[model samples]
Target: MLLFITIGALCLLLTIVGDLVKLLQLSKLFRCISGSACSDELQQQLKEARVKVERVRQSSNATSHYTYTVKLMRAENELKAIQTKLRNESNMQNLKGASVELVVGYLLKGVLSLVLFIITLRNRYTPVFLFNENINFEPLEGLLSFPTGVHNAISVPFWALSCNSAFRLLFNAIKGK
Candidate 1:
């Protein structure tokens, strides 16, 4: 489980790094065309730069997609292996039940971690006002809150659903139906 978590984290990091690199490269490509234009040579250079940026963007996108697919498949395989191991170790017939328990455990842990992180961050950065005498608003609050809220709200449900689907497939595999 720890290994799977680490792999997932690494995959996420790689995806983010790949995205940032692509964006930076695209920015540089755009910056290359910032001079006074309309000359034939300048126009040709801009056209070529645009083409190269497009190609780079497409390739990066394809690579990102491929990496995600591979990671997902690997995760699925790991889950399947866990299920098999559990079955072989115990003669329990309630594989679905066990899967449900596993999913619930994961969801609870993830949500708790998110809540703790948010609380810690809020405590660290948010100013505590006394008696509502004065209020201070930081410009970065919205930026920070939006992503944390969005990630916790979106990713938890997405992962839960994916786990449920994966468990269903595992069930099917187990029944040999």
Candidate 2:
């Protein structure tokens, strides 16, 4: 059970970390785009978006889990508008790099999941929940095996998001908006 809980927590932590990393990357992308041959209005908007992301990162200190959660939520909400604006402004020719990044991110996640699954299988498909005790049994093994399923299930949405992100980038680029 402890092992299950640990895996669950790890999944949640990874998801949050992924979002934070994306926020920072998007912020940097906005800054870079702003410096390109875009309109002054677009440049200003991009800078504002980057500033909002920076503020979220600063406020979402990991000192307390609750504080981090709240701030992440705040960051996500704030980013929605920025995302929409970027979607409006995206061009396929310009976002080829972003599309590549999306693919790389998905592949990395896939590799990580595969490695974890391999590790679990090597450990006899049982997680070491407690240090002093062996947590192996038919019933317990059945129960413990659920963590991998849970982890996989949890990762599905992130994979979908990766697909959506790549598709949106392509679609917007093709639309020439």
Candidate 3:
């Protein structure tokens, strides 16, 4: 019972924190904290590419019909490619914060899931709630018990899921959404 309560509380806490992070829009701070090395490098490359394109355009003979020379075309393509890369980098940076937090949240959730699995496996025969009278709903009993074989039981995973659902509902209600 103590283990169940502890696990329920932890699951509730994790769900609440995950919700808060999304609701508060703290992803930008996370992205900033994650650094801007990729964007910075792309910007530098964009500048160099622009310079090469400009130099190629200027060095070509103005009076000649060969204006679209191979060098100039190649430089222009490189410049355009770099510009595209920089644009993509900026876009990715905008999403990075949210993605980073999502990954961390997933990792924490995974650890919690493992703990639940271990707990359930250890207490396979122990019913979370014992019925005073026998209830012969085999399918429902099996589902409620899940990893545990105990009849009329609520397993750790089920309990944790309930805790998460309850907390999320409360959180959303408090958030007015």
Candidate 4:
């Protein structure tokens, strides 16, 4: 049980790390989009916001933290402005490529999760050829099953988002929106 819990925790940690990496890549993508859209002002806002966010991170007191929260909100608003500007001005080809990449990533995640689910389910139903018949570890199935379930849960939203993005991009390409 401990081993399974440890594995589950490790899996969650890995997922979080993966999401952070995705966010970092997205920030870089935003920078590129802003540059191409001639959003110098928005870029400056982001830089300032980042600095303020860092300052917020450094502060320990609640009163100062509240002020930092305001700064963070302002920063988020600026980010939304930047996104709007980029959406209006970014190159269609670049946007389409990015959308395609995102779709592929999401679909791949969904496919892998499906595969894991099938494998775990099969293991649960079938005999363990490698293990002795006298030895039982039915509890271990919970470990495999739980992780597969979690993966499936996480993958579904990504798949949906990817599909939605891809369809929007397709429509935009067709309509020049």
Lowest lDDT block of 10, candidate 3:
125-134
Sort the candidates on TM-score, descending order: 3, 2, 4, 1
Candidate 1 local lDDT, 85-155, one digit each (tens): 54443333244334544455456556544653454444433322122225332553343334234311223
lDDT of each: 0.43, 0.51, 0.73, 0.49
Question: Positional deviation of 71 in candidate 3, in angstroms?
Answer: 23
Candidate 3 residue spans exceeding 4 A from truth? 20-30, 33-89, 127-162
Best-performing candidate as measured by lDDT: 3
Scanning candidate 1 in windows of ten residues, the lowest lDDT window is 124-133
Question: What's the ranking of the predictions by lDDT, best on top?
Answer: 3, 2, 4, 1
Cα lDDT for residue 25, model 2? 71
79-99: candidate 3 lDDT, tens digit per residue: 899888877866777788668
Q: In model 4, what is the error at residue 57, expressed in angstroms?
A: 49
Candidate 2 on 38-95: residue-level lDDT in tens? 4456667767767876776786554587877777677667567766656666564246
1-177: candidate 4 lDDT, tens digit per residue? 332233343333333443444555654565465454456665676677667666665664655767878866776676677667656654554675466556655665565456534544444433222334565546553443342343112222233333345644665576565
